[model samples]
Target: MTIKVLVVDDSALIRQLLGEIIRQSPDMQLVGVAQDAYVARDMVNQFAPDVITLDIEMPKVDGLTFLDRLMKARPTPVLMISTLTEAGAEATLRALELGAVDFIAKPKLDVAQGIAEYSQQILDKIRMAATSHVRRARRGESGPPANFVNSGTEKLIAIGASTGGTEAIKEVLRELPANSPAIVITQHMPPGFTTTYAKRLDSICAVSVSEAKDGERVLPGHAYIAPGNLHMHIDKYGADYRISLLDTERVSGHKPSVDVMFNSLAKCAGKNVLAIILTGMGKDGAIGMQAIKAAGGVTLAQDEQSCVVFGMPKEAIRLGAVDSILPLEEISRMALAELNRLGAGTRL
Candidate 1:
């Protein structure tokens, strides 16, 4: 089936660049091009495009306001186009919270050339959005914080995600108690955005969340996110675990790759680690999750019904790496329960 797409951007250059890109894709049809939210709204209703590429910094009705309104009125899969600045990162994160499927950063210079260079990525995101689950804003509060008994053995929670991970990570972190074990996360994101994402999570979650720095000791009650464009791994130093950032080649087609992080955790923490593969668009974490399982670490995958895109988790389950498949809302609680059982010396 051919995917229909609408381009909504204030810049005429972006409209033309993206329109051409879409028109050139045999599998995608450029339904309409809107210069602002008002025109985008009409085009949306008229064309009923399968995917909408929206810009956040538009005049009159901004993308966020329009997105919020659109999601409430008529939900559709939306991909965001944003600047690579700090403010743009914040707004893009909010757009995801409001229901955008994914985002691509607008280049600061040479817009036309940049968009052309990003053509393949733009096409991939558009295709992913067309098939992804468009989750509406739940407006739900985080469940009660989990309380866990200390097992003396240091525990680690290693999480990996891509496409819809910002919200998924938030959902897991918010549900963790202040005494939860050290958490290391690898979420595929750009350099400037990861810092903002960590800060945003810190503000709302019970656990202290921050961008992981090289050689920092991993501590309980804190969630450390791998910096964008770097691979983060857990290394044991004496009796303590420390975060190690690698300026290495991309594994599984992503820097800060989930597979790298998961494999490291499996090797370093062994059975004491809880590995989770969340919603994403590729098979990045599957082999590493298998390593985790082989090392006796517990593994969990988000089920298809709850995943925005069930790619990574599905791949892990296919490899027989996951011990349990659970919904997004139930993962935190289940992880805590499993941790308790592990602490009590029960087999996972």
Candidate 2:
């Protein structure tokens, strides 16, 4: 069956480009085009499209407001098309928070050629969005995570996720106490978006969260998010651990890949690590999580029902990389419990 798609963009050029891209795909069909949210709303009702490519900066009604209203009222799979300007970054993040499955950054110039250059990415995101579980926002807790206290063991926790990871990561982090072990995270995202994501989580969580800086020590209570578009790895210098960013070729088809971070954690921290492979779309972290398990580290994989795609964690489970599989809500609490067990020398 050809996947039905609706293009919503104020720019005629962008609409034309996206329409062309959708038409060229044998697996997808462009059902309609709308220049603004008003028309887009009508088209959505008329076409009942399987996926909608929604632009952030539209005339009449801004995409953020429309997205917020749409997700609450009707719920549809949306792939955000946005520019990552400084202000645009925050708006894009909010859009994701609202309900966008994923986004493709709009090129600042050569609109037609740029869209063409990224045609495959556009099509792929659309496909993924169509099959994805569109989750509505259920506001989580504010303030520090439940269990508390700073254990100065110089411990490190590494997390890797993609696809539905943004909210999944937030759910896990929101449960961490002020004195939680230092965390390093790699969430598949576009360039210029990770910084904003880190900031957003920081604002709500008790921990001091920031985009990882190379050579900075991995300190307790602070969470470091790998800067997007760059592969971030853990490095050990004696008892101290810091991050090293690499611009190397994409691993498992992602830059700032989960595999890169998890592998580095397994090699550097070994048994001192507590790692989790959360919701995502590929096998990037399976081998790396297995390495962690081999090195005596405790590993957690989000259970299948809780995952948006179930590809990454499912692969890890198949590979015997996971020590236990937990529902999404239990992960953070269980992580703290396991950390306490390890810190106190109690048997797992």
Candidate 3:
């Protein structure tokens, strides 16, 4: 089936360029084009597009605020398109938090000469955005979860995400408490960005967060993010699990794939692990999460509404791999509760 798309931008040139790109793809169709969020909203009702490419800067209502409102009212996958400036970067980050599936940097010059240069990337992003699961905002709340803790079992936590994962991972990690379980996350990112992202998370979260190093012991009160360009897996030596970084071939088109981490957890940690599949672009974690479930491990998939891109978790859920589906904000608490329950032998 052809994926229907809506293009939203104030610039007539951009709208035309994006529409042409979408129409050129055999698997995609441009359902409508809007100059701003207001027009986009009306188009959403009329056209019922499967995906939207939103501009970050616009008159009347800014993209971020419009995104927030859009998610709150009628959740739909949104791909943000912005310039590659510092302000654009910051705005792109905020747009992710507001439920944008992914972002593409606009070229500096508006020359029609190079407009086709980014067509492939733009098409790829549009295809990915079509598979996202967006959630409507809950009534009367826009802040982080007030109660965030994992009290069920004391086992380690393993998470995997890709594509739009950088921002999705940040939202979940920022809500975690200092005493959160030892979390090992594999997010698809470039090398330098992972270090910056880890440090960024460390600054915002109550928990101690850092990039995982080879042979580093997984410990509570700390969150370890896998470095980019490498695959990070867990190894159980004695009573504790340690990080194992390897220079390996990409799995599911990602170096630090969720599958690699989840498979390692199934082999080394098994029932002593809480595995979570969050918003991402592909089906990386489905089989691996199944392994975890088969090994008697507890697994959770972020629900469609809470996901920026539902591909990863949706695949896992489709395979009957996830034991529960929770929102992004509720995941930390659910994880903690599951950990505590496992520790107390109250729940499996």
Candidate 4:
């Protein structure tokens, strides 16, 4: 199936570049080009493109507002293009929370060539977004059980997700109690966005959530998200496990790769870890999940019916690394139960 894509940007150069890129991809077709949100809205009605590349900084109406309306009205997959700045980072984060499937960082330099520099990557994201599931951003806290008590296991949860994982990870964390084990997440994201994603999760989760700092002791009841463009590794600080963020070479095509984090955990935390591979579009976590399983850690994967895309978890399951598979809704409850059992010295 030829993927239909609409380019929404104020820059004529970007629109032309994107159009050229789409036309170059055999699987993609250029549906339309809209210079602003108003034009984009009308183009959406007329073209019904499978995927939309939306610029955040546009005149008349901002991309976030337009994205909000698009999600509510048509519920299509949107990939945002934002400037590579702090403000752009914040807006991109909001766009994700508002149901954008993904985003690309607009180059600060080179106007025309920058867009083409990552032409293949642009096409890949557009394809993924075209077939991706766009779900409603769910809210409300579902704290673990009313009578939940600290199991005192000193264990930490390591979660990896991509594509549709922002909401999936949020769903699991929303059920965590104040005494839940520490969590370290490696979600595929760019540098300015992970901090905001952590903050967003912190606001809604029952536990303390923050972006992971290098060499920081990871405490219980706190979740640390691996910052974008960095790889997070687990280390032992006396009796406690600490996080170390490094600017290492990309693993599995991502900086904060799931395999990198999980492999590090397998070496550092060993049997005390609970590794989860959630919805995503690639196999980044599969090998790392195997390492965790080999180290006797409990591994869980999100089942296909609940996954936005079954690529990551499916690879792990096929590799015989996953111990159990659960739907998105049951993941939280099951995680809590597994932690309680693991704390009681039960083998899962």
Give candidate 3's whole-model lDDT.
0.80
Kindly list the per-residue Cα lDDT of model 4 for residues 114-200, writing each as its tens digit. 555688788888988987778766666464542235455458789999988887888888877877788999999888778878888
Show model 1 residue runs off by greater than 4 Å: 108-116, 151-153, 344-348
- Clash pairs, candidate 1, are none
**Better model by lDDT: candidate 1 vs candidate 2:** 1
Per-residue lDDT of 93 in model 4: 74
lDDT of the structure predicted as candidate 1: 0.91
Worst 10 residues of 1 by lDDT: 107-116
- Tens-digit per-residue lDDT, 22-44, candidate 1: 99999999999999899999998
What clash count goes with each model? Answer: 0, 0, 16, 0
Question: Model 2 misses residue 193 by how many Å?
Answer: 1.2
Query: If the candidates were sorted by their TM-score against the true structure, best first, what order would they fall in?
Result: 1, 2, 4, 3
Quick one: best TM-score, which candidate?
A: 1
Per-candidate TM vs. native? 0.96, 0.94, 0.73, 0.92
lDDT of 1 at 29: 97
**lDDT of each residue in 1-348, candidate 3, tens digit only:** 899999999999889888888888999989999998889889999988899899989999988998998888778888888765556666776677676777887654446576666898788888877765564433442355334334433377788887667766776776667766678999886565567677777887877889889999888778899887899988887666889999999998888777999999999878888898888877998999999999999999888886767788989999999999998778777876777666633222
Q: Which run of 10 residues does model 4 get worst, by summed lDDT?
A: 144-153
